[model samples]
Target: MSLEDLVRGAAAEARRLAAAFPAAGRKDDLPWAVIAAFDADVRGHVERDRRIEDERDRVLIASVTLAETPAEAEAEEWDRARRHLVRAVDYLEETVLRFGIVNRLAAKRGHGAAGDPVSALRRG
Candidate 1:
């Protein structure tokens, strides 16, 4: 799927999950481990999706630079590079979805009712 489509989907899902975290009482002074999970979950989603965009753009640039020498480039080398870049992009998108879920879970649980303690998550 396109990067914009992927990001929009992630954002929508994150919002849905965040809305539910509180009703489930998922916040009950969750264990440090759980909190860590929550943090990772949220950050992971954001960072992963971001990384996907970054890697994709990077690959686009590199690929463009290499386009002039298609005959000179080894097939195997090109294939390998393409595979790695695709994998990186996939990983980024997956993580973004995962962390988005975690953030939603956290928000639903009243983890930030008094104030958003995890404001960092809101930042880019």
Candidate 2:
């Protein structure tokens, strides 16, 4: 799948996981499963983009840590997970925007695909 689609899917899953927290309760395993799948998708994307890997890795790590850490109360844990999910969604949305901008710029420059913008410019 395209990076945009992968990111969108992950974002949707994150939102679903966030929504599940309140109804599933702390002991439920469903949210954890969703989180694991989401993390894998994010990690795979990060791995594919070495240029931004460090920054994205940090964000992913921080979000996962925050989301996974147990709180004294169930409510607090759910709240934290929801907040992290919101940030994840925001990050994914920004990524989608960046992809759109890059694709537009590539098309304008007469490139057939959004691959190595610098190289395309050098060729031109």
Candidate 3:
């Protein structure tokens, strides 16, 4: 899927989880699942997608600076490699920050639930 689509999906899931942040009364595994998936998608792109090496590198660095696991560390490093592309993304009409809010909230929820930073990156 396109990066925008992925971010939107992640943002939607984050909003869903935020609606039930503590997950005290939730019955489904949607939040966890969505977070896991989102993280995995980001990780996948950083590791294999070559269409936008620069964008991928920037994202990977930002993500790694934000991760707390060996896997996450690796993924984040890949993102960092494309730091030079930051300027390009800034010029683009579609910014990655669109999903910033939701992504943060989701991270908090994942950390609280799984006690692992990387786990928060994923949907489940």
Q: Which candidate wins on TM-score? A: 2
| TM-score-based ranking | 2, 1, 3
Ranking by lDDT: 2, 1, 3
Candidates in order, TM-scores: namely: 0.31, 0.45, 0.29
Query: Lowest summed lDDT over 10 consecutive residues: which window, candidate 3?
Result: 111-120
Tens-digit lDDT string for candidate 3 (1-124):
3444554565454434433322332324432443444565443332233333444344334333223223334544534432322333332212333222233334443322222222223433
| Highest-scoring model, lDDT | 2
lDDT by residue (61-94, candidate 2, tens digit) is: 5456544656556776667666765675556545
Per-residue lDDT of candidate 1, residues 1-124 (tens digit) = 2222434453344333333323323333212222233234344333234544554354344333333324456867655544443444345445443343323444454433222323334433
Task: lDDT for model 2, please.
Answer: 0.49
lDDT of 3 at 112: 29
On TM-score, who's better, 1 or 2?
2
After the best TM-score superposition of candidate 2, give how far the Cα of residue 102 lies from its true spot, in angstroms.
11
Pairs with backbone N, CA or C atoms under 3 Å apart (clashes), candidate 2? none
User: Where does candidate 1 clash, by residue pair?
Assistant: 17-104, 18-104, 21-108, 21-109, 22-108, 22-109, 41-99, 45-96
